[model samples]
Target: MSIWISWMVAAGVVVILELFTGTFYLLMIAIGLVAGGLVALMGSGHELPYIVAGIVGVAATLALHRSKYGWKKNSDASQDPNVNMDIGQSITVKEWQDNGNGKFSARAMYRGALWDVELVAPAAAAGVFTIVEVQGSRLMVRA
Candidate 1:
């Protein structure tokens, strides 16, 4: 078998594996394998192809690691609207059951279900509130 063909096969295998993992790291390595295949196709020395592949793979991985998509934001998922669709959505709090100790909470209907909601701060009761965060089944809201 031709050396270039072997490199292409390896790259194909890596790409297939990448589909299952859903991360781009394997895709970068596959790109490196494709680079090796290109070097071999140019009739470079066997050792030269290996070196090119290694360098390309490492560089691509590092580049990906530096990209925004590669790293997750530090924001809490409960407060992020992107993670919890309920965030930023408004709900009605007909009344507040004062828990005393300077805390106010109530059960409100949301998304066709009853939800435990608490004010972000101890404030006067209001008919409307905006969801700020979700903790398990409980929702934190603000006026």
Candidate 2:
């Protein structure tokens, strides 16, 4: 087929990939493909169309990366119950001992993993404790 047809075909493939990926990043490449296709149809030299396409793709993609559209930060991911189910879940401590740091600490089994737990302020004597928050592999607890 013609050079322009090739470019259009590539653009269509990228657009289809963007749908599956749920990210608009491939759309930026599609923009460049369309640009190159236009130049190819205009009878530009072989190298010129590719150069224009690369420049347009890179520039447009960078512009998109800098924008706060698809590149947004979700502040709720930290607090979302579905995202972090262990936040409100309970943890059981065999014993709460003050190894240091004033607050009581213990090694407890949570989700089949041994976690270093720190009881908030006045620590519980022992037994079942509710998980207040989790930072890394450590658990912050409240009795």
| Per-residue lDDT of model 1, residues 13-124, tens digit only | 9999999999999999999999999999999998999999999999999999899868766999999998999999999999898788878899999999999999886675
Q: After superposition, how far is residue 81 of candidate 1 from its true place, in Å?
A: 3.4
Off by over 4 Å in 2: 74-143
Judged by whole-model lDDT over C-alpha atoms, candidate 1 comes out at 0.93
CA shift at 121, candidate 2, in angstroms? 20
lDDT of 2 at 23: 83
Number of colliding residue pairs in each model: 0, 0
Highest TM-score scorer: 1
Provide the lowest-lDDT 10-residue window in model 1.
Answer: 119-128
Report, for every candidate in turn, its global Cα lDDT versus the true structure.
0.93, 0.86
lDDT of model 2 at position 27: 96
Q: What TM-score does each of the candidates earn? A: 0.81, 0.53
Superposing all C-alpha atoms, what RMSD in Å does each candidate have to the true structure? 2.5, 6.1
TM-score: model 1 vs. ground truth: 0.81
